[model samples]
Target: MTILVEKPVLALEPKDVSNKDDSEKEMAAKNGFFAPEINSFGNSFRDYNAESARQSTVEEFYRLQHINQTYNFVKRMRAEYAKLNRMEMGIWECCELLNEVVDDSDPDLDEPQIMHLLQTAEAIRKDYPDEDWLHLTALIHDLGKVLLLPQFGGLPQWAVVGDTFPLGCAFDDSIVHNKVAKQNGTTLPPAALFIIRFHSFYPLHTAGAYKHLLNDEDAKSLNWLHIFNKYDLYSKSKDKIDIEKVKPYYMSLIEKYFPAKLKW
Candidate 1:
């Protein structure tokens, strides 16, 4: 059965920071806020060049992820993991777990995942101090990658991380390897969920390719998701942040939004 879907015309223009609140502007100045750029390696960020040291491994990771991330596999994974029976720990503990891990799929930075989380959250906080929810959202967006740990199902990097896309629809060209799904069992706010699920769905947000699948609410959330992609994707750097200094602030946020201990 073939059905025709009309893509909505969206005026998703970029927001001007020049007119932002004075406090935010001041914060940006103090923090050296600027648009994200390519890494020091002289390659474009996420460039999978065959000659690059990280490219072969990154490509292989995506190759496996693309081949195995099928619809039935997704369903099976959701059923297995949704029980959330793995461990009971505070959110900061989960963040600490990532210190032992690095993302093999990433070509830009090779630091531990917790460093990336802190870099992303700190970058966003500098530009939008009032948006505490957004700051928290950046901190924990990749917590799902803990699936790589032996205690939490020990899933392969292919199954746990990489660019994401919608599964039942066409694989848009903007998404890397272009395959995916939404999640369930999350108690996060709609906006946070939008960022968590679709942050990897670059085809829709970056290329404007999945407008036909979106309704009014999806469109509204898309705005914030766009704002978040900047920090999530491009905030990696060699600059180190002192974890002890910032840990208390993020712990407070976790306590506010999440219970003292979560199921996973």
Candidate 2:
């Protein structure tokens, strides 16, 4: 399906170094290339280094995530959440709700969750202007993190945010939190769902691990996931987005792929 999305008037411009703090300047310098280098904190993106203050808390979050995110726990959470009874709201409403959320598990960003979502979607939109479904996919990919909110059962950060891996299989070494634990397309294509579900499964896509667990369909979906990962991981920055200016554009895309209101 060809989704019609109005391009927002406020383009996401490059950060002006003159206005940035020392750390932000350093980060902007590192992000000079398509694939940026270590973060401004001088730690690799998602580094989780034991001694680095910026990464240490993230490491601890992973420690808890690794121990608790077992097959049974995943299964139970799926069963409970699959009911979709938390609340009913439009996709944009959910996006606005994320303005109050922060991902404690992320080492790269401390901003509100909506910024990351918009940043990723806008970055992908700029590069793949014709792929409106991909743009919408990027916007809603992390809507699942709404589980962290009180109305959604108030799940801990470990349960909602952070990199995700498969529960039925062994954790792969390439996954960032290995030391601790562990998509869609056009009208929200099947490929887009695959990317949203498994982007954090770095072992399968990035590391060439876990081939044994994937069937033929999964193998095919892996290709799109690889393409999606670049924008998802590398689009993050210290730059702020003007939500009021961009909200109309994303709201249009959300209307295309999803109902006005979705079950939580």
Candidate 3:
């Protein structure tokens, strides 16, 4: 005999969704926080083939990063940078420093780095109000780009920014900032660390590369990273976020998770 069992409505039922969601959605629409289908340059986001002034620079950056980021090179960079001796400053201070840095690797927006950080953070905050850690993650995700500044050793754009990847046999490209956060004593959870570490890892998260290396824990963390990446990439635009208005809120989060001053 064949039997069929009744299925429960496991997905979020309409009644389960609170009015807060509707209100948040309305606010997002009113403020134009919705993710755009096209990037600021009138092309799909991360389209390396799109012809523009930035296309050549981005392509060159990838070429250099792939050729130079070998296993021994990454190991040396990691060990040398792990000392955290660059400088002692608070998280907010680091945000201020990013105003001087520009990411030539990015093709979409040419605005100051701080604006991008705020835009990403505010977007995440509006959508996921309760996840303060996520909001903070968005804000400080690229602060590691400060490595491009003179005081931070004035590293080249190829070393400091762009899509990072593992350097060994199955190499792909991404960023390298998790060490700064971890060695600096961040109390954020593993998921937060994973997102911060691999947000620029488009190969693993976007193209499904490097799957063989992930554990069950990394799989669970990938879910959060996927959500974080949406804001990280799509939030790029010419729109300017009010720094003074959002400063107080992000400061509270920094205090909650990191010490007043961190090494490097």
User: Using Cα atoms with residue i matched to residue i, what is each candidate's TM-score against the true structure?
Assistant: 0.84, 0.81, 0.84
Q: Tens digits of per-residue lDDT for model 2 on 54-161?
A: 576787788888888888988899899878777788888888889989888877777788998998888777656767777888888898888888999999888888
Instruction: Give the alpha carbon lDDT tens digit for every residue of 75-178 in model 1.
Output: 99989888877878888999999998889888887889999999999988877776677778899999988999999989999899888766766666676754
lDDT of 1 at 240: 88
Provide the global lDDT of candidate 1 against the true structure: 0.78
Candidate 2's C-alpha runs over 4 A off are 1-33, 181-186
| Residue-wise C-alpha lDDT for candidate 3, range 61-169, written one tens digit per residue | 7667656666787788788778899889999999998888778878877778999999999987766777788888898899889988889888888788887677656
TM-score of decoy 3? 0.84
Model 3, clash count?
8
Off by over 4 Å in 1: 1-15, 18-32, 177-188
Q: What's the true lDDT of residue 115 in model 3?
A: 90
CA lDDT of 245 in candidate 1? 99
For candidate 3, the 10 contiguous residues with the lowest summed lDDT are 8-17
